[model samples]
Target: MTEDSAEYLQRKEFYNRMLTVYGRKPVLEVLQDNSLEIHKLHLADSNKPAAILDDMVKLAKKRGIEVCYHDKQALSRISKNSKQDQGVAADVIGKGFQSHQSFLSSNKKHYRILALDGVTNPQNVGMIIRSACASPINAIILPEKGCAKLDPLVIKASTGTLFRAPILRCKTLASCLKAFAESGADIIGLDANAPHTLGEEPLTGAKVFVLGNETEGLSSDVRAICNKHVSIPMLNNVESLNVAVTASLIAFQGAL
Candidate 1:
């Protein structure tokens, strides 16, 4: 890589104020996914390349994202999991970031949304975001803390879906739940202990699917506001499903 190209990718890291997404695929996806101007791009090693890598170099140039070449060790050090930074990273300008108020509407009774009380896993969060983007859900509300952001692991796990979805935020789960009620979206508490099955209820109306943390599920305070509850039947010895699978099941099948 030329000295100028090396300087380019180094600068792309500046776009990550609220997010620090890493990995080659995730970074590339972010670079290709959005047209927003970027500061720079980081690459593992593009000095010597094959057909694919050569083409990738051209694309990087075409997008106006400065390309920097670093070794595998450097790339790994920069990634979230230190897994697959591949020699590529970027600092980009965020397209848009929405607030909690923007997620609500006073005039509508049928507004589909998602409220995640304490989801912590970036992979699960990314999967849920992928599901939400595919479903009719209007937006996903995540706590401002103790939750995943636009981490590279999430961006990779989300398969670039993060670029399309709108994730809202609140300081606390209770405040998010309160806003849900005031906004007129039915809150569906998905609990293993809940008696009602998601299938038994009419889920066509505007609703918010509250996916909880892996171990504790929804907190006592958060579940109290639920207008309805859902539980998938446990067949055989299976106790439960992953929260993303459960949520996706409810989103696609519940509405049918």
Candidate 2:
């Protein structure tokens, strides 16, 4: 391959591992963590001088991190949330973040993945990440769209476990599930009216347990992709459990 092509591939791989965190306090907290690998610190030119901003700069400089100043518009584009960005953002190298293609390339003998489909609540997403990180689950399949962005609220909810969670990102849940299904992985979905319960059948080999949206459940496209469906048996008149709680159960399904 040409040198330029090689460099482009390298850059793409590098960015696939990055998670941009915005908001002043969140950026500051990320900077404070010594274990995190920060790529760069971003600041808006219009940011009014504050003690916290000064501290952020000091911390970045102390750690020899590159700092870039951008216009408010550019910074907003970088953070993807203008109102909540607070004129600051930081690029954190997520050591555990990777593309699903990368994970498939590894050719592991057996694995279990928790796939989130249209889960928009940031807290739910965070809690799910925490459970998956703490459990025997190999990774989380998080779609870039139709899901909560990795923001400060999610980081807070995860109790800082977001940085360490094995997150496999995709553009769409349906397409990712299709890819996995084609690769000999069982695409399982959680539903309320499914014929079987969650743990009734043996979950062996490559498996993906999908948790749907909070209010709407799974999207039609994602639902169509699910080859198998199972329900979490409810007691009494209870209809269902929260998505995050369901994720915890699925994460620890093997252990129990």
Leading candidate by TM-score: 2
Q: All candidates: CA RMSD in angstroms?
A: 8.3, 1.7
Shift of residue 59 alpha carbon in model 1, Å: 7.0
lDDT of 1 at 40: 67
Measured on C-alpha atoms, candidate 2 has an lDDT of: 0.92
- Model 2 lDDT, residue 14, Cα: 82
Candidate 1 accuracy as lDDT: 0.69
For model 1, how does the per-residue alpha-carbon lDDT over 1-256 read when each residue is reduced to its tens digit?
4545745534422232234456545555666664555556766774356554565567779877677777767766655455545555666554433556544534556666677877888899889888877886667777865577567767767776775666665678788788778767788888887898877866567788788888889888888888888888888878779988986776566445
lDDT of 2 by residue, 1-256 (tens): 5656978767777898999999888999999999999999999999999999999999999999999999999999999999899999999998899989889989886898999999999999999999989998999999998999888889999999999899998988888899898899888999988989988858678989899999899889988988899999998978889999999999998797
| RMSD of model 1 against the true structure | 8.3
Which run of 10 residues does model 1 get worst, by summed lDDT? 9-18
Q: What root-mean-square deviation over C-alphas does model 2 reach?
A: 1.7
